[model samples]
Target: MERVIGGSDRSAVGGRVPACPGPQAPGQGAVARSVTVRLDRRSLRGWHIRLLDQLGQRPDRRVRIAWVTQGSGLPGNAEVLFRLEAAIHGLPRPGLATAAEPVALAPYEARPDETVQTGDDIILDVSGAPAAPAAAPVWRLDFDGVPGEAGLLAALFARRAPVAALRGPDGAPVAVGRLGAESHTVMLAAFEDYLARTITLIAAALDGAGSPTLPDGAEAPLQPGRTFDLDGFGAGRRAAGGLARQVARRLYALCFQGPQWRVGWRQVVGPDLIDLRRHPEGGWNDLPDDGRRFYADPFAIARDGAVTLFVEEFDYRRGKGVISAVGFEAGGPRGRPEPVLELETHLSYPFVFEADGQAWMIPESHASGTIDLYRATAFPRGWVHEAVLVDGVVASDATLLQHNGRWWLFATVRTGGGSYSDTLHLWHAPHFRGPWTPHRRNPVLIDVGSARAAGPVVARGGALIRPVQDCRGGYGAALGLARILRLDEEGYAQRVETRLGPGAAWPGSRLHMLSAAGGLEFIDGSRPARPRLLR
Candidate 1:
């Protein structure tokens, strides 16, 4: 076979890299090691990658590899890996064993980041550290629901995972993309998914290649459930110092990864049979509540009215995710609940309550990517989607509560471009109608501990209580009981005195929560009664 050297030829070529005898792994606080480069085509770098895999994280997976390059603002800005004997100067003058050649002269698999364009050439002048080489200093501030939560905000949204350098399930490393501020919400979520999916990939890669096992990345303190000390991280600011900035930088460097991140899971309850007497259509269809093909978030209230449960009924099967209500008073109910508010598609987070002699509702309207409130025009049977309190939300499951003469709203944000099911964001308004202002500390609350919204119900004791989903164990497997100590401009602070019973609700390894309910009410929502065929 003619040795198809480097350049823009999309062909399969193979070679091997020599070995390195330096540091073996990149631990939480460890230094990176250099690998031996061999071969002739930019393929040598490819070879170097393969060599590193044999020296992988665990014996079973390929070693994760990342190239560090000084960033360029221009179009083709990235380090181009090439063959040892490839060209350096003007254009390529290919020789058997020449001085060097640019990877731009290489085949697809032999080149780095597969999308390199033709006009793009290698610039070898600069060198920098790979992502895993960065550091993450501890953050002590807890944005207890105030504004300008710089320290905590920076830390919470910091791209702090070493995902690109981690081996995938097949012993291959993740392809790293450009790194900088994740300015948009979509980028943030994409980043989070990247990190998480990379980990899974590494795990699968390792399994496939008969390599050693890696620790579950999602379960670590440095990952999905990352912890920050509340001392350095509160709603109020401490002294502004270079130290804070340094910590932020270190975190960005040390823990940042391709997938931006957050956290999930708690004690998930079932798709209990909601007496659909409200949806008098009768057998329009029957659905289960076991949480099979659907899940829901509901609030039960008894006003001058009857016991009504407002829920966001999600039909993963029908894909027609909608919002509806079901009512069942203690007297053993008469008829099945019916669907009241129906939409074409995309509606969730059906949080219902009565205020000022009127009923109000908020459901997850992710399609519009905004928050909307509805008014019950005709008791429990009819609702009109009236107002949009907030728009451009990259978050879900919003909660609005009237507190201390002012109205406070809580919602989980997918910060650092990670999972929508992770990270928490807060906001408030003087009135429920909301000329709503983002809590100065927008994501005033965080912690995979309760990053996502479980429920923000108030307690009978007068002090506020929030049921937090403890995703540490897994989604909805456990719950945390948090007491809202303060929610004023002074900054919101919370004391999670206890974690609600881990195995108290469902007999599984997960949990899910929606909205804040008042005094001793059974949370209700749409759930499937039987197991789902999750294809």
Candidate 2:
């Protein structure tokens, strides 16, 4: 780069930038010796340059780049000054390896509204070839933080090339709209840096008219008390994220692994809440009893005189899968218990219903990666693999309900997370048999409170009332009631409202609750009906 100091050549192409003018030259604000006003054109997303000379602070050690966003209000040109030493005990750090801001050259050649983050200075080499208008010089551009760069740019860096030479279908490096992720996030990082520097050089030549000079002693300290900061996973960034992460960890521990299961429950099995195991017409063995510890779903009442209760009993201490069922007299021996169905490996969320005189059950079939429907051959223990409703699918806690004359299935899908209790998707069909269509607004509902169906039941008022687990405070945090306000061709609309909780009754301190609740009528597997799975 050649330069003629203090001449008309100062603003010529291929010239050096005039050194940051010491002690002023009118309204212009440039103190760096070699800064150019022109650059190689590239991406124009949210780019801006910080005028350090205008901040009243001298560049001391290095520019600390903190990509901070304003919490509220249009803080244009309002530098969100952050204090470091006070934020942390001293110098803060981040989870990433490098802490210093990446070094960068300016970019004004392609755009004017370039808002730059302060101190973005780490200089990594990238393997990428820029794509632009036919005559635009083939170049590389740095992309600091665009979202999907992880997959695209990272792969490019893995190619082990400091520069990626991707051309167009015409094998032309310089063409309009020919840019794609060179491959990996890191590669993209390097590519962005390379181009940024090139663009800076170009703009410098244009601004200085080929006469540029580097500033002398431009390094000075910044704002008073501006120290280092760290964040949630380590480096202090924002206060909101750190607290949110802690809240998430605590929730996972209390829900599935909570001691509520360890403390054997003394659920009174007769008619009402406090009837215990004894009564005038029924003894401990008088009321129907299913020796199972937990009901996978509360018992479902058949229009006839039979009550079906699906129980989730697993030997977590022994192995992974263990589930069976128990049948009790609806109004007879009361406590006499018998086994119903013990699946081979694992089975849960048993959905039972007697439709058109035939009994059907669909348990949580997600373990097998398929949804299978079973038909009861006998009242107590006989069940056969009646139908393969949905295969190669992932549906759990599949509860069935007849709504708007169509059968709707609700389940929490295995959509890429451990918090299965959070999101719920819906599928509907005119017949309980085949052709299930996913809700157009599939994830029509999201609110940890009612994401998972408690158990499907036809409300006494003839409306579909679904019990839901409220996870606002925590998982299984509370029991909630949801009435399907509207279910039609238009779509499904439901509202969840808090109903009962641990404070609702004795032994109900955040009780494992509301799978299904109703009345049953039958003596074991026989007559005199009136039976329901209470809690």
Candidate 3:
């Protein structure tokens, strides 16, 4: 089953998500404080309502919303674009309402906030220039180098500019991000996704742990500080073509499932993709699977003179995934994968490794809002719940690494209401089992193309090599190898060195995972598959 953004419509009834723990200052904890949000009265959107409710729900703050009438509203064509895209895309109209009418604000007593006026032409003063280093009393949103939503349409639909939150007075960017969409064909869905992430960015900024630099762009650099004019970019013509393609895609899905994933394995004599930086010759051998289920996220281990491979077995009938394993002998899989672990919630990315002289697995259990540890009592099958490493988080592909006498957990988290991949979060602990502390800079990176972990982190030549999923094209559409340049308590960083995708060597449209153990390498990708009856 497809997984969309979680908790998107929570604002409908003022639902509350768990508040992100803000980083404590050098000597001060997050004490309760009064916060007033300044907004443009004319361009109120559903995200604004959600943002206010989110801030108000924080226990560390008393929140109130104030509307100012001095800012420009959304462009004249924004509503027209939304209505047309909604009709063409068949999106959830009620839940994906981008435009919202002004609602009653909570009664709040006025406070004395020092204000500075800019002549009589009030341009919604929050922060002024891109180079200002000081902060103002209020906050404002900027799109395509302008205040308010004057350039929102051209930015999102045309230029694809980075969104920024500027503090008043100096307008310095606390959080700046280059947003992305799951699919560009559906304009409505893309628009909603951008707004969801935008809210997450602002919330982080308010918490004082905001990132000062732009998220790392592995394939390309992001110019979040650049300014451009608010001009048209032929959005009308592009919309017409997108509508036609979207309709065709829907019609095709009616006859068959969208795509099915499968695992591929091959024996290697020397260095694998980690060192070669290219696909091995003679292609790969398929790990056969039954027509009812597909396998992905292959993780392997070599122990006691035996090599075992684990994968995420997703059955079409059940609509959920479970962990399974297959042994390799004589340079080939022994048989089809057998169910090794199952749970009430969906599971994938079975990150299996040896710790404390025993086998342990940390599968993706973000569906249950926790990252858990399981110990194997009977080798690969008898798994017991050991402990909860991290809680109250929707983290995917939880990969663990032990470096410099400290255990670090890496995963891409779904911040508030956004895509499953994009925002990368880090947590560190003394051991793999006990209490885990979130990094001071929670979201260390936010690039959709290279944020999500695809497989294990391997050590080679005193440097950590990470396998990441390139989701810029789509979820798991390609794979990349990044060199972890610096990873410590102070901060974390990586530079993507190589990217690989499906082509002549791999006859598919998607190539996602990569892992190696005992001279055996494994990878997975997508291909077309049909039901038994249809086949």
Candidate 4:
């Protein structure tokens, strides 16, 4: 037997049942029960209609849903309805021998506004009411309809060290449900991407399918003692302003304050690996380039007693980067850096390696939506396109390493318009250049601080050390040295050992890239530049 309960008015479902139905008899066909929810037709909105449509798609017949319509004037009434629909969809199905248990409809209590105290400083205002407890010491989230906010709160609440609660506008406790966050410009392309990702997140959260956190590790809130106020940063203010003001701000940024990156190098003396902490403060050499063009992502290789350095030469006027290299000896560059490879699209992170007695380079060509491979025909300069390792993806900073007779490629990828610096994806191949396959756990890591590949992977004393960029402060804010604990087809994991920031040791505003070869280490940092204005 199947039943549909609708609101306090039992008249909708032909009044209340004489008694709750029990287990079904044997040899009966599968009984599928679906409840068609009907909100007040006069108050039906787009979201309400969408909720009903989603609920109508359930195939299970043995499940039950508690339908309640109480306190229609509550601030989060619509949100509650949405959450109820999600909860109903999440319920387990009843077995063939027994009927599903009855779902009890709970009444929503509406009260006056009050302040709720929490350990974390985030203030959530539902319907402009501030009713929350004052003595709790756990991370508190204002149960408002915001994308990414639910996952953030859920992660904090999962810690369980402190008490957490979700309250409604009337200051009544409520159950946490699906939440998502998305933002975009007025452009149709941008809005489409944002909508697609927002839908994916909402479905995943409600279904309990994937990780319960944002890709950029939004779950990990700002560390204690370090305060970051979104209001103080003016981000909220700008978002609330008129579209003209936003356009003006963007134009100003484009005309001035463009990114300018420069590469720096230091000579190491012995066979032992360089202890990055003890690196000297001075004697750092800067790569030479014209003001219109900047160089970064320094990768060096020594072959037949000759050392050559490869870098990404970015031309600001053209807004693209091409691979360039220069000969380096003991003191400094043997000659001016020359362009070794050019592509129509932007490229960086010239990851060069030797395999099967052939030189190969995998430059960051995410702009082309492909990870490509290039083979050197004439050693240092002459290069030819070998193959497309991975296609139809936006990936950056691909670094390859050989371990246990298999090759692994690590790179940060953008998924459904998410942040490019957070989700790390891996692929493995029997050889360096052909027949590559994605790792079972494609995005093995999701952390803004250590997801992007910054430099080459090195083995030191049986431990694999990887250089990663920490972008919490901003993109390329600092560099982190992470040790890979486990890496295989099934999974991947790493732990950051130490972090290096730009200060007395390296006099710059940002330090991002790190690479070592032939007793020399190279890094890149950014410094503030005075933009030239044309009268």
Runs of candidate 4 exceeding 4 Å displacement: 1-259, 270-274, 530-535
Clash totals for all models, in order? 110, 85, 3, 12
**C-alpha-based local distance difference test score of model 2:** 0.38
lDDT of 4: 0.54
Predicted candidate 4 versus true structure: per-residue lDDT over 1-535, tens digit per residue: 1112332211224454232144431112212132222122122223232222343343331111212221011111222222222222232111111111111111111122312222211122211111223232211122222111222222222322111123322333222333322322222222223223333432332232334334443342332343433111122112223323333333334334433568888777653223645446454687776665678888998877778899998654444578999988768788767899997666788999888888999999765668999999998888899999998777889999999999999999874344568999999999888588999988899999999989988888889999999987766778898999999999888999888877666666678988877777788977554484422
lDDT, each prediction: 0.40, 0.38, 0.66, 0.54
Predicted candidate 1 versus true structure: per-residue lDDT over 1-535, tens digit per residue: 1111222221223643333334333222222222111122221212122223333343211212223232111111001101101111122211111112222222212333333222221111111111121221110101111111122223333434322232222223222221123332222233333323333433332233212223443211122333322222222233123324433332233222211111111221322112111111211111234332233555666666466665565432243456666655443223533567777645666777778799888877654547788899887867887788887665577777787788877887642233455566777888889898887776676676766566646554567767677765544445566778878866978877656432323222333553322221343221222232232
Q: Ten residues in a row with the worst lDDT in model 1?
A: 73-82
Model 3 Cα lDDT, one tens digit per residue, 237-295: 23333433433333234224434578989999776888888888878888887655679
Positional deviation of 388 in candidate 2, in angstroms?
2.8
Off by over 4 Å in 2: 1-258, 262-296, 329-339, 515-535
- Per-prediction CA RMSD (Å): 22.8, 20.0, 17.4, 19.3
TM-score attained by model 4: 0.53
lDDT of 1: 0.40
Q: Which candidate's lDDT is highest?
A: 3
Model 1 off-target regions past 4 Å?
Answer: 1-295, 331-334, 501-506, 514-520, 524-535
Off by over 4 Å in 3: 1-258, 528-535
- lDDT-best of 3 and 4: 3
